[model samples]
Target: MATQTLALTRLAASAWGCSVRRAKELYTKVIRSVLAYGASAWHKVADTKKGPALSLTTVQNSCLRTVTGAYKATPQCYLETEAAVPPLDLYLSARAASFEIPTETTGKLQLLRGACIKAAEIINRERSARRRRQRRPQGATSETPVTLWPSDAQLASAKQWLGGQTVEKALKEKWEQRWFHAVTPTRGRRELAAESPPDCGACHRYDDMLKHEASVLMQACTGRIGLRSFLFTCRVPDVPTPLCNCGEGRETAEHLILYCKDFKESREHLATQLAPNSLRTRRDLAALTTKKDTARLIVKWLLRTGRLPLYKRAMEVGGPPEHVNLFRP
Candidate 1:
């Protein structure tokens, strides 16, 4: 119980932008995940009669390798441990080398511990090398720096970041570079790259709102419009707007889709399709569902499914919001 509690405490801290009411809702999910893994591990070690009695180090070592497989399934929970744990270098190396190391089905905590140790060593070595380079006389010319542009894959990712294209060919190439690139002091041009089905650039507070908007778009468009159905079959071209609206700026999803005159035509077109009769009085579709039940259904439809055109269209016009589309191919 203590082990799982420790894990959730770490998790709740990282789940940014949750309301106290919403946080209670989210906690059940977090607790379930922490307990699920802990329960599974406890069961595996139950015969030893050491389930609740294991040390923290023992628990961590048993959990690390399985952590990858679990992460691939329950990503949100994986994120809870992100800040407290070392980078999962063993997992990375396993991907890089493409070789499997046998782990005890009994548990993966030890494997994780070893991986963590190795990650620490690698980090230490890299830091030492960096200090050595810094100590060298300033007059010495450093090795010629690489000014590589995006490869085909990287270029596709770059385009995706720019909110342009999402061909499978393009996405595959972009991820290939993303998987191998070294972190440098200088930020890359495409650092802010986030598109639907990949990156979601929205405030945590507004994530649910954006999702509701997508559903409303989808529900309204699918039956009456051809564009919505077409988007259901294809990837929408993304338009990356990297400008931040933090300092008296107003380029958020609400501003773009509802308030901004730039998207007036598109918004009107959608409003006409979704709720044409309601369009005259409804200046803001988002504002229409202040009632909890209506809002919940809208959010569910938008965030959970891909049948609607509004969902994909919003994704194209707006960078990915937190309401994720699991159906995108």
Candidate 2:
């Protein structure tokens, strides 16, 4: 079932046809619903044992990757955060717990409800303990674990004990911490992540962009573009150093967009469109890309610079008709 669903998901999220936001909607509404159809019956085993959840998780990760157009090696956590999708296990547990059974419900149905409640409690307890250990100081004596679940009275009213919003918040926090302490290899992404919102500002605005333009913008934002800095990190044989042809700094997405000397004329034109405030720093760039109008300007600026050669044809084909006159006096 998951195998068949994955094929449909891939087609829906294919680079040429779908926007990131639409892909995510399709996953949540169609793919996820199908995969977790009978989750209430088996969610306990799926949560307690790693094997049962692996297939579901694999499908989700593939779908998320397609949605974001991120590289194969991008971390799963990054994909989840960017796509604003919860972890598969957390989602399954929540889905199981949300089943509403009547007071007169008996036999297997009633037993299933009890089982789901217990599974949610157990899963919450384990997650709490694991988080406590992660937060513990190195070589520090372990303290008594606190009860993470709500009181019995509270639990009665908490249909979604593992609520989607709560899970999403925790996931964002975890992803932020990872981004903050990330090593040099992810410098570009780390910097962008710091300035952007937890759910990724650009992703939410993809609906306003052409498919090709959105794809290029996402790649540029995530530091997976054809830039010399990225190529050097990937150890592409031809890119000996991460320097720009302008001989000023590493040829990164940020550099190309904000500071490349060769793009001076184009930058001036871009600045005119941006108005009032000039694009001088990452914050400026982040703020610009989050809005539909300014993000289109960013894409146009990128196309004008001609830095991302791999996307040139696609951008030109889907670009505005007057894009050729973007920098003309």
Q: Best candidate per lDDT, number?
A: 2
- Most TM-score-accurate candidate: 2
For model 2, the superposed segments whose C-alpha errors exceed 4 Å read 1-15, 45-49, 100-189, 200-202, 319-329
- For model 1, residues 20-99, the per-residue Cα lDDT tens digits are 22333333344334433433222221111233334432333323212211212222212222111222221122221121
Where does candidate 1 stray beyond 4 Å? 1-26, 29-249, 276-286, 289-329
Clashing residue pairs found in predicted model 2: none
lDDT of 2 at 111: 59
Per-structure clash totals for the candidates: 16, 0
In terms of lDDT, model 1 sits at 0.33
Cα lDDT of candidate 2 equals 0.64
Judge candidate 2 at residue 134 and give its lDDT: 83
- For residues 1-329, write the lDDT of model 2, one tens digit per residue: 66755665555432355667767777788888887888755665222325567777888887877776766656665566567676676567555555432222344545555776787778778966786878966787654543332233323422334343453454445445554554344444444534553464445766666656666666666666678887898999988999999999999778987888998888888898889866888878877776778877887788667777776666656744444423111
TM-score of 1: 0.21
